[model samples]
Target: MTSLTCDVAVIGAGTAGLAAERNARKHGARTLLIDPEFAGTTCATVGCMPSKLLIAAARAAHQARESDLFGIRTGPVEVDGPAVMARLRRERDRFVSATRKDFDALPEGTRIRARARFDGLAGRLSGGQARLILDDERVVTARAVVIATGSAPMVPGPFAALGDLALTNETLFDLPDLPRSLAVIGGGAIGLELAQALARLGVSVTLFDSGTRLGGVRCDRIHATLKKAMAEEMTLRLGVTPEPSKDGRAERIAWEDGEATFDRVLVAAGRPPNVAGLGLETTGLRLDDHGMPEVDPRTMQCGDAPIFMAGDANGARPVLHEASAEGAIAGRNAVAWPAVVPSRRKTPFTITFTDPPLVSIGEDPDDSAAIGSADYGNQGRARVEGRNRGLARLYAAAPDGRLIGADLFCPGADHLGHLLVWAMEAGQTATDLLTRPTYHPTLEEGLRGALRQICRAVPLELPGDSDPGQPPGL
Candidate 1:
């Protein structure tokens, strides 16, 4: 048997744990990073990256099919599924080679193959006793621990007996052939994005959501347009519940009038934190009523007797990105301070990648006494790019003039996310954005226009001196 110890034991290699390890190494703390098998999951190898690759391929396929709309005539476009998958793999390998090197190449870093749970004295291995296991064989010891384990796709209630004949985001892309028809169990982010993607791939898709509306992360301003766009592509089974078919052929969907069957079912309500087993009790880590490790928000610390927690395992939503950020903070605190203070710089931003992806920045829309905003219906770029289909909703401070939040639904969403993220972080008011000129014809200018209108409605402080049409000093 082999035994080792480190100053910090980060128990996940997913987004947050990996980030934590990098920061810890930078601070010269000896780090031990552990995960069950691969160092990646939905976000890296499977979930976000691969899903986006598939979406891009689907978009290309859509373009080829709709070439006549752009005055390019061609024969019918067919999908080369295998080649598309190969491209995804080649790209994935290139990405892994680069990003994985960032961690595996870290000096003084230790990675163990086995999974360790909290044993009473120290983490124990089978038949190896450097430290004694709990009398009941469930406890372990560590100087300090951070749980950065992330979340997984939620399983649907109707498919309770679904051992097979089911797909979650984790396993959906593993198919060699696309299903003829897909019944999406939930109409949240995953369902909307995937339904559109599969529909473009020539699969008949039916989206089922219990609410009267679809798209869980939709904004009030663009919700109707997004719903209409998606409805044109797939069956919109809104305001309905689905019961498991007796034979599991398809969901027995219950709507106001009738029901039907589908070839495959996709469960995509949301993500649940991956918190089970691992024996949190040995460290005296207390879980909230939800059976997740409870932590102090500012410090991201949890567990009792020298333990801390981060990531989805602790029940954080908007999970991955936050977990990665929180994990770095938690890991650094666990090593240097040991006093356990956790902090993050900015509020979380979220996106849903349907056709014309939807992005959101700060405060919830339902909040009372709404702040000032500008919508992007009247931008030149919108008309030029042929996407007058989306909206940009901005929110700002009451009277002091600070940008609070923005939710964007439009084309080029992947690029738009970075722009909005920058604006929100800089506390750039609508006036600030307008002061910075965007190029003549681009989606970005629409963002600038949206800001200009919002500022005109409830004007914020301007540049020291301004021209009527140009940004400061331009």
Candidate 2:
């Protein structure tokens, strides 16, 4: 059998694994990265990129269809579904190529096309080095290991129905044509994102979740806003338990209260750590009570001499951004001069890319009192732009006025990354935001108004002390 050794071994060549390899190489460590699949899921070939391409095309079709609102008229609309899929496929190939190039770019890093598993727990190889075996029976020895083998969609309760019609995030982009109607199974970020995008594309969509959509968000207000905006189209089945997947025009899914029908079932219930057949027993790494690898939170070190876990397999947030960040941190720290462990950072910001979008950062809503909020239903720019329905909430330290959290219900909240990051890391205060110059008639100016509005909640007296509804001259 072929054998090799490296300073660091990263299992899984997805975003997390690739990032880990790059960081390890940067720190002057020899690294080996491996995954069974040539094309990484989500970030690379199928997940976010291709899906968003579909969303953009879908939205463009929608806007073009509604041009009458703009005092313009166009021919009756027909969505070219197959054309959209073709474009998505072309984009996906590019991403896959880019990911492979990222691996090739890292010096001293070797890419292996195989799955790996620990072979023994002696904590030392027969040759006084740690050893792992590949699926093809090739052996590898590494001083440190980083398991960035990321996550995949969980099969919903009814496994039998997955036959052909059912699709998950990994398989959705392969569709040659959009479904006439789509039933998204799960109300979490994945479910909501796809549901909204498909619905806007003229696919009748029904979103089902056992819990509330946007569950566990720090702000209920944010969820409410999302619901209001999303309700413009699509059916949202909240707090619903789904039925088994079955063959039919309408997949019959049941909840505790009742059942419903959907055309295409897209299961995105959740992700479990990819731990099966990993040969952890050979490394003396025991699964925790929750059946996840028990490891030091800061170091992610498993048992014995060299095995470490990162990304979704480590049971961290199953978010691509978080996994990639964690991988970078863990990979570099694992190979530092004497190998100093890294501390995990607070998840910075997450957004649901629905209309108007929803964002949450820092303070869990349990600390909502530290939170202050402002809304702009009708403002100068909003009116001029013929836009409304935006809100921004601030969570600050009561003692120092430092901003801890900022949830935006406005447009382009994603681009507020730098300011928001500073607020969290540097403890900048709401008042400090005043110093940042905001362009007039731009969406950003709304931040200033939101800041002032949240900072002061005093009731303002109306003109003439009138209730306005009591007749002006009376």
Compute the lDDT of residue 97 as modeled in candidate 1.
60
Q: Give the top-scoring candidate (TM-score).
A: 2
Residue 461 alpha-carbon offset, candidate 2, angstroms: 23
- Residue 170 in model 2: lDDT: 79
Clash tally, candidates in order: 10, 3
| Highest lDDT model number | 2
How do the residues 201-306 of candidate 2 rate in per-residue lDDT, one tens digit apiece? 7788887777875634556787787777777777777877777556465576677777766667888787678887777766756667655667665666664346
Q: Write the per-residue lDDT of candidate 1 for residues 207-262, one digit (tens) a residue.
A: 88888666655466567767878888998988787765645455454566777776
RMSD of each predicted structure: 4.8, 5.3
Where's the lowest-lDDT run of ten residues in candidate 1? 124-133
Error of 1 at 271 (Å): 2.1
**Regions of candidate 1 where Cα sits further than 4 Å from its true position:** 1-4, 39-41, 93-103, 106-109, 120-140, 157-160, 246-256, 303-305, 317-320, 365-378, 461-474
Each candidate's TM vs. the true structure? 0.86, 0.88
Give the total clashing residue pairs for model 2.
3
